[model samples]
Structure formats: structure tokens, C-alpha cells
Target: MNANQTQINSLSAQSNPTPIVGIIGGGVAGATTALHLSEQGYNVVLVEKNDSLVSGPPICHLHAGGNLYREISDEQCIELLKDSIESVKLYPHTINRRPTVIATPNHDQHDPQSLFPRLLQVQQHYKQLIDLDPSNKVLGEPDDYFKVFTKQQLLALKEQQQPAHPTTIEQWLIPFAQQVDLDTLRYPVVTVQEYGWSVFRLSAQAELSLSLESKCQLQLSSKVTNIEFNPHQAKPWAVSIHSQGQTQQLQVDYLINACGFRSGSLDNLANIKRTRLVEFKAAYVANWDDNQLLWPEVIFHGQRGTPQGMAQLTPYGKHVYQLHGMTEDITLFKNGLVISDNDSQPKLPTPLLNKIDIGWSEEVVAQRTQSAISHIAQYIPSFNSASLGGKPLYGAQQIPGDDVSLRATSVWFGEQNYACIETVKASSCLPAAIKIAQQLKLTGLEPSHRSSAAEESSNKALTESDIEQYAVRLARRRGYPEALALYYGQ
Candidate 1:
């Protein structure tokens, strides 16, 4: 045998009796889980059906709490954003703290400060929601400016001979009045918290790098066909994997289903009682030549009774940007549980949903690409002038709802020692990983393993854009930024 194969065989022959966690899926969720588990000194075997760790077309712009969610308290919202920031920081380089702005079409002109009253009222509504929920606790201190800001106080900042302490609103809008373009929709540029854009390839690299440490075994391009429960033994699962037209059995103490869209299928194999709903939401990336047109991530709002449901534009620097104007949400499930092939029916809005499924197809991709370009052109007139980058990217995700609320991260099915995660947001992956590790009560680290923590601490000075730059660097090394075009375009 060759030297490299001999070395790999030597490493694989050395077996450990430590508890094993079998994690299915290699997306951010599964990767983070395996990394955390390995850090805690447990053996981890992470299996993915795809060759690469991050499969499917790229998804970009990890949304911090600026505008995504609703019906949750400001505290909970801010916490989620903070979690997003912290999670990205775990990687060596991958996030950019680009400013995000929301722009409404010009109408009756009002001072930018006038919006503070409505914002304050919205905060009060959230405060009431917090008061009603007894279980919800404000864990960390949220941004004071976000929690409390009065119009009178902000106005005083403008009136003062440099008032001692200015509110965040006044600080952000110092040049707001001067830059107001009444003719276009660039009037009230609300500077939100430093929203970071997570570079897709770099993020995948970071997650995979962290997981492939001393204790973790990664199996790519392997499919789990069946899982047998071994309740009588310490290792509770005998997972049967199919790869390269061969079958093998692996004994594992714990099984975590981190399969994002196909999590429901894995759960069913474990005989776990649950239902899964999925949807196909069309999206596209439009790259423009005008660097001056680049502004903070823009969310365009429509007037009452308008057909458009909040369109989004996030700049990925280098004169390229992404656009998502969600068409009618095509529901993949009817009422409750998707039992069989007949029950799991796709309610396709466009024929493209069938033609271009989870993966890309040429004809459907072309149709959806045109649809995306046309939809964004209505609100963004400049899109008409921009050139198409390449073939349009398309993909879908499982629908998250109240029926699967408690199991959004990880939940234990009592019988089989199986846990399933339904992670809708990439930001939730790290926190979910730590939580599942604690839930499983994995053992503490050895003295040698403590060096990992020290290494992480030493690399603490990296910036948000460092990772994006790293992604660009790697992409250039590979001759093109094909996978990273949605974040850092070439």
C-alpha cells in the first residue's frame, strides 16, 4: 500500500471505547454538534450524503435580529442577534459587520427623528409580551438604544451645544437630513446594529475544520439507510450506512439528526413521532457594476394592499448583490404529518418547483432567474442595467412552525436515545450544539484536549470581514469564486 493510505489505515485501526455520537447531515448544525461533542472528549462520526460538507447551492446573509422575526420580545430578539454574532466569531474568518438599512418609498416628508416614536411604541409592545411570559428571562443586557429611546431626548441632542450623551438615533442620523433624497427612496436610512454577512464557503470550512479535530471521524458521501435501536446495551443505536454500493454497521451511544430539510425522514427511521412541513421559496443573486449604488442591506416595503411581500437587497461588496423577493410560499405539506409519497405533495406555484427541485436544473433555473430579475426590477429600477452574473442559483428549506417548536434545536425521543434538530437559521447552530452537548452530559476534556481552548483564545483578534476576505482568497486560489458569489463575488 502507498504511504498515505498506510497512515490512514493506521489511524483508523486505533479504536477508542469512549462514547460515540452519530450525527447525520453535515450542514452547519451537524458540523457544530460534532465539533462540540468532540471537544467534550466524545467520539463523533458525522455522515453526509453530499461530497462537500455544505451541499446544495449557496445561501447567504445571515440575518441578525434587525428585521427578520416578529411576535418575540426585544430581549429575545436581541439575544438571537447576539448569538448570531458570537457563533460567527467562533470561526477564524467568515462574517462582515456591514451596516443594514431599511428604505421606504418617498412620501410626505418627515424628519428622521419622527420614526423614533413608532419604534418606541414597538418596544413597549414587546415589553408587554415579555411581562406575559413567565418562563422567558432576559439573559443578557440588550442594546440600551434599542430598548429605550425617546424623541424628546433625541431632539434635545440635535438642539444642544453638543449634548453630553447622545442617543443612538441622533448619532446615526447626524447626516440623515442632509442625505435625504425625496425624489428616490433613500430618505430615512435607519442604521441598524452591525449586521454581519456570513461567507458560505468559509463558514463551511470553519465548521468542518473545527469538527475534524483529534476525536471526530468524518464520513462524506455516505447515506444512512436504516437505524436499529439497541436499548439493551450502553450503545443504543446500530446505524446501517450505505456507501459506494457497500453496507456497514456502526454502533453509537447517541444519534443526533442534524439533517436540515430531510430531518423528518431521519426521524421517521428512528421511529420518532413527529411531523415535517417543507416549502419551496424562490431566490436569486443580481450583480451590478455600480459601486456607488452599494448601500447598507436594503429592505423595500410596499404600500397597503400591494402585491409585493417585503423584498430584500444585501450587498456582497465588489459591485455584486443578492435579491430575494419571495413569491407565494409553495407549501410542501397539506395539513399535518407527511406520511408517504402520496401525503408529501408539493404545492408548486410555478412549474419550476418541480423541474428545479433541491438541486439545480438548466430550464427551471433559467425561468426562476428571469422571474427574480423581473420581480426586483419593479422596485429597484437600477437592476434593469446590471448584467447577469452566471446561471441563477435555486434551492429550498423545510418550513419551521409551532408544531415543531420545542424540537427546533434538539429533542430526545425517549425510546431510541435519538435526538433531532430542525434548525431554520444557521446562527442557532452553535448554541444548539452546546445545549445538546450539555443535554447528553458528555464527559469533560483531558489535559491534552485543553490546548484547543487555548488555540481559540489566541486567534481572537480576527475581524468580521477577515473570513470573507479569506473566502475570496481561497476562491481566487481555486481560479474563481463560484461558490462564494452570493457573499464575496469575484
Candidate 2:
């Protein structure tokens, strides 16, 4: 063997009595898996083509109960609630602790009341989670999981002064009531306990935690070139990675495909055929400097992929907001969603791939961002004044099957000792890791006492201030405003 192969083999040899798991793609799924497996004493090598983790897609909302989407089933909502709570526990520093305002426009056929049943189910499920573990009370009291406001109540609050800092649910609504065009909205509005999640903060936490983990080897700016699997070998998988202008080979007992939208590419390399869909989407960043009042995330529900598509306004600190319009002209692109054919990978169109691999043109960014601004201005007329804050946060997401409506998913095991995480949301990462750990146990690989290492690292304690500092650095490094890393109303 060459010197590089010898070095990799020597490193693999040090992980005695535990398996070496090679995880591809350093997004939320891969990062969480690496941290969990490393804590359990399994040596982990995490590979990401990018410089940072959790930077693939824009994860702005913690879909507690999947309330943002109306078409998903109640079961999915409950699962999302459970998963979101777990995510908050794992990455508390990432949550913005802000509620969301859900409204139905007057022209939309879907009534606001139709969401009550699922909201009730989610509230009860959240109660159950908290009862089992009081620490799961991340969203707030189950009794107040969601609140309803009549038009009269909103009209009364519209004239009230916005609070310096909103401490209660109603206080959070004051700014929304003041700005939202009451005539265009339906009679009653619903505000849920769903909160904002910062991907930048999550990236910061994962990088810091992984750096502290002795069992995990984080390889940023590394791309996997090839994979060879032989069932007879002691280490069944040989993963070839290209990094820093050099190629290195790693021997791992198991392979985990947590590659997000690029997951199908790995399956192709492994000769594992699986049906999946990949959809590319974007959210625009805008600065509304005149509106200093801290506003809750606002959502106007409408049909997906239509002219009256859903308009979402997510607030970051320093008067910065992220906007998503579900229509074709805004967030949703024509031919953006593609299905996998006979090959495991779904080929994205070249132009879309250019936006993902390279970057969007300045002219395209300006046009689309302006369109998003106008889309939001329909509900909040004053939003027309908002200007572009920075480049749009855009990436593609992977769905396991043809169902584009599938919101909640976890780990999917392929052949023996090979697992692929098909998570649609950031919240789904923890449960996927748990299921993978269980599968590892079934394979007769006992967890080491080093499981306490995770707790010990947690004891080291990354304060919110530390997270903010790191998050700002990461945001700036990634060409986003530092305000995106700060929580609104903090």
C-alpha cells in the first residue's frame, strides 16, 4: 500500500471493538449521525464537499406539528412535533423561540378552521412527549400550543403599540396585526408554537461539537470519487475520497448515505437502485429596515404551484427577513422537481445544477427577489419597500418516493450494513440516528462505554453567546449577512 493508504489503514486500526462508519454528505443528517455514532464509540469519518455542515438547504422553520403544510396527514404532523422537540433538545441554540402566524386569504378555498383537528392532535402528542420527559417542553405549555384570534381581536390589537419585546403569544401578534391587511385575510387567524430555526447556528454547533469529538474525523472540502464493496473483506467498503488535490482511500465496515439531495449519486456508485425525487427550491433574503417591530413568522396559505401560492415571511434579527413564494416565478422553478429513472440518481437540469454547484446570476437574483417582495406585498402592502438583503438561500432536497407531499421520513436501510437516511426536514435527523443505532445493535455491535463522551462534551457547554459568535463567522464566511445568525428579539 502507498503511504496515504497506510496512514488511513493505521487510523482505522485504532477503532478496535467498534465499527468505522463512513458517512457521506455533511448536511444535517450526516453531521447528526457522525456525532451520535462517535458518541457511541464508533469511529466516524464525515465527508462534505462544502466547507461547512448544514449548509445545503435553507432550514428556516422548525415545523413543529408540520403546521406549515396543509395537505400532510395528521400522523405526519404528530411525528413532526415529536421530531421537532428532539431537534430542539439536540440543538437548542438554533431555535429562535418565536411563534408563527398562520392565516388564510379571503380568496383561498381552504378555511382556517380546517387546521383545528390536526392542531389538536399535535398538541396532545406534544403533551404526551412532555409527560414522558419534562425536558421535551421546548415549544411551551401544551395547553397553549396554539391560539386563535378573531378579526375583532386583531383589529383591536392593530392600533396598539408594538411591544419592545414580546413575552406572550398575544404580544407577538400585535406586530402582525398592525401590518397585515385585515380585509384580505379570513375572519380568524391562528398562531402556533412553531419557531424559527437558523441553519447557520446549527452549522456552528455541529462543527464545534464534531471538532471536540475524538472518534469523528471531519473532512470538509472533500469529495468522494469512488466506492468498492466486497462482502468477504473484514472492512467491506473501500471509499475513495479526493481532498486538497490528493486522493485518499478509507476502509470502513459500514457505509451511510446521508447525502441529502445528492444521496442518489452514492446509491448509483454502490449499484443500489432506489426510486426517489429531488426538488430544487430557493428562499430570498430581504431587509425591511422601516419595520423595526419584531414580527412573528407570517404565512398566508394558498395552493402550491399556483398563482396564489403560499407566501412565507421569516424574520431574522436586524430587520432582515427571508421570503418564500411557492409559485413558479418565485421559489418553485419550472422543471425543478425530477424523478429518478432506471438509474438511482435523478438528473437535475444543467441550469438548475449551475445554480446549485456554482451560483445564481445577479440579474436572476434581483428579478426573483423582487418578485418575492411583491408576492408578500399582496398581504402586507408595506412589504413592497423591502430590498434585497443578500443572495438567496437555495438548494435541492431529496424525497424517498414519488410523493412530493411526503413531509416526514427517517432512515431507510438498503443491503446489509448499508443505511441511507431519507430525511426531508432537519428535525428528522435525530430519529434517523436513533434507528441507525438500533440497527447497529442488532448487528451484534455493542456500544462502548464511551457513550458518556457525548454527555461529557455537552458538559463542556457551548453558551448561546459562543454559538452566536461562531454562527456570525460562519454566516459571513458563507456570504450571508451576520444578522441571519442572530435570533430575532434576542
Candidate 3:
């Protein structure tokens, strides 16, 4: 055995041994890192505070196209897409494979007539970037993965749907339809999870595979309250875990903080100050009777009359859709504590605003929600704000928020063996995982082996009964009658 392998065997005292990595958090970044590490032949103790695997509020679905998709490097993008393909396979019911249509009613500066061609220009740019990766040759072609709607085809389709929810094309795009009549304006570039696929369902799928791994010590309903560090010791750091109203410690050669929003909390225990940058945004879920109104996630640009200059409308299912206004300003902080606001709240005097913790409030959410509803109505004319019924169906409260501030794309403090993923969005978790793996010196495993295993796992099919049962459980937890009816009869 090599010197490193010999050392691991000595520390672990196993005939067949590997180093132990204590992964804290059950979110996408944490889960993916733990899974990838285990596949690299490491002993992973996946610890989570929730009783079930996917423990946490259901936030935004897996939006394949977003800030993460646009901002990340091309190499990172390739890894992200590959990881997403593998992950969606485990729980196909969680994702909607339809093409996402990104449109804007108000063009900021670009000529409106040339907008479709401009979109193609950007697509070609991204497509060229993805093509650079050799692994993609075997994985799939970037062009085939997405479809671009041509303007000519779109004009033709619009003529066929004439005078329906009639509107001049100059004023707005076609109304919501299963297939947008203006296909030329639509691009199937993004995908999201089914609205009802809560965190519990997504996490449970990973927990199953994690449980089957012999080397993994999966801990649930557990909390890591402290970290004991001794630089002189062979294993420099040990984690103090609290679970079942008891406490215990685990010595580790390395550690990774994949605790999503709680990452700052863990870093603080290690005496490292990292900040999480977050925005408090709201969503308004409105009812639409047209089951045929299928839309890939729609992102409308230009903020002229809306709450923010831009709005994103996501379809929860066929009959329900959610609308959100972009955050005009943001609050910055470290370790889950807000430090300052980007803009002063006009209504509240500076002194009063400073005295009160004026973060996201009921008033702000309400105003923004109403404004977003009105803005979306410009295109979706049949949309009525009254149909919003009440508060957003999916609230901001569901997302767990914590982070250790990092200025770089992704940062890890190797001295303390802790890293922070400044996730642009959850879909970018895979690149974060790959980054963590490389930093931990766990890249000894061959790339071919890793690819083969991922491929093999992707091919493992899930049964209909499995998906239906998942729906039943989700229905029970969220109390969604549609979920139960979609699976078991109401």
C-alpha cells in the first residue's frame, strides 16, 4: 500500500480502509459531496438534524437556468449539468422536463425585432462553451439537450391561435398555452422540480442510497454542537455531535461544512466567521383552470412597471403557478446575523429602522406580491390577483438560511477544514461538491471509475409505485389534497 493508504488504515484500523469525512447537512450540496466522496472510497458519516433525509422547507424548485447557469464558468456548468442528469434520475417525478420559456414584454435597450436572434446568439455562446468539455461527447451534445424556438414558427403559431386571449404582439406575447404559440420566442432551456416535491421527498431518495453504503455511518436527527481542534494531533479535529439527547465525538482527518444555510453556525463553532448573503422574496400562487397552460419556467425582463424590474413566473403544476418579483435591494450579514441593509426603507425613519430588525416584513411581502401579480397580468391577461386566494402557497419561511461569507466563487478554509459554498442557486451544488472534493485531496480515484458509477446509477430505474408512494407521503406532510388524489384516490 502507498504511504497515504497505510496511514488511513492505521487511523481507521480496518482491513480495507479509507479516511472519514464528516459531512454536515442534508441539502443538495452536502448530499452530493457525501455521495461523491463515498464513491471515491471514503468513509462518510452523513449527519443531519432532521428525522428523515430531506429535512427542510420546500423553497424554489430545481431551476436549471438561473443566475448559477449564467454566471458559472463553462467547465463548472458541464459538471453541474452532468450531476443534475444523474440526480434527476433517482427521482424523476421531482422534475419537469419541459422546455423553459424565457421572455420579456419590455425590452430595455435591444431592438425588439432582433430579440429572437439575440437569444440565439447567447445560446450559441453557451453551447460552444459546453462543447469544449470532451466528456460531453459521450454524455450528450449540448445543442440536442435544448431547443430554440424560431421567430417564423412562432408567428405562424400565433396566427393559428388568433383572437383567443387577443393582444397585439407589440404589446405582449401569446397567452399561456401547453406549447407557447410564439415558439420562436420560447426556448426550452430550463427545468424545475414538480411543485409538490418537498425537501422530504428529495432527501429520502438520497438517504436510501446512503443507507446501503457499508462505509457510511448515516446519522439523522443529530446536531453538531462543537468542534474540538488540536493542531498537534494526528487527526487534528474532532466533532462533538448531539443526538437523542446525548453527546458524542468523532475524530476526522478532514471536515466539510455542507450545511446549506446553517454553514455559518457550524463555522462559528470552529471560531471561523463566515457570512451568508440572502434575500427575502415572496411568491404568489394563482389558480389557472387551463391544464393545458404548460410553461417552462418563465423569466420576464424589464422592471418598468413591476415591483422589481424583472419577474420570474414558475409553474407549480398544470393548474397552479407562482410569481415572484426580483429583489430590488438586499441585506448583507455574517453568520446569519444581518449587518446592514442595501437601501434605507423610505417609510421607516432611519432611527426607527435601525432600532427595529426591519428585515423582510409582512407589509413588504404583500406589496411586492401584489405588484408582481399585476406585472405578470400584462402577458397572462386571464390572470387575476384575487385568484391568489391568500398568502403565497410557497412561503419564504420554508427555506433554511445560513452561510459563511466568502468572496470567491467558492471558498474553503483549509486551516480549519471548513468550506462555504456561495451557491448562486441550489442547482449549482454539483460544482461545489467537485470543488470540495478536490480541496480535500480526495481526488485519488480515477475519473473513468467515477463516470461509470454515475452512469450505472442513472440507469437504475424507479418504479411507478415508488413515485406514487412518494406523492402520498408528500401529500400527507403538506396536506395537499391534489397530491393524494394524484397518487391514491381522494
Top TM-score hit: 2
Q: What lDDT does candidate 3 reach at residue 299?
A: 61
Residue-level lDDT for 170 in candidate 2: 85
Error of 3 at 205 (Å): 2.8
lDDT tens per residue, model 1, 1-490: 4332233334334454556788998877788777767766767788887665654324555545534333235554455554565565555355443444555554413344554554455445435444765322231112322422233433443443422232333443332222323244534445444344544654445544653376667777788899888669666688787776767777777888887756667766766655445544444555677433324455555431134545566666566656665444211212322222422222344444443443456564455555556655665565666555444434445544434222223333344557776555666677777777776763332212336564453234344454455555544543333434234311
Q: Model-by-model lDDT, in order?
A: 0.52, 0.89, 0.48
Worst-scoring 10-residue span by lDDT in model 3? 329-338
Q: Write the per-residue lDDT of candidate 3 for residues 76-187, one digit (tens) a residue.
A: 4444444454445444554533334455343333334433343344345446655675432322344534343445545545445434222222112233332332332333
How would you encode candidate 2's per-residue C-alpha lDDT over 239-321 as one tens digit per residue?
99887778888888889999999899999999999999999999999999989888999999999999899999999889999
Model 3 residue 431 CA deviation in Å: 1.9
Best by lDDT: 2
Tell how far residue 318 is off in model 3, in angstroms: 4.9
Task: Tell me the TM-score of each prediction against the true structure.
Answer: 0.71, 0.97, 0.67
Q: Which stretches of model 1 miss by more than 4 angstroms?
A: 1-17, 56-58, 70-76, 105-187, 291-293, 302-306, 329-363, 400-415, 442-490
Q: What lDDT, from 0 to 1, does candidate 2 have?
A: 0.89
- In candidate 1 the C-alpha lDDT for residue 35 amounts to 73
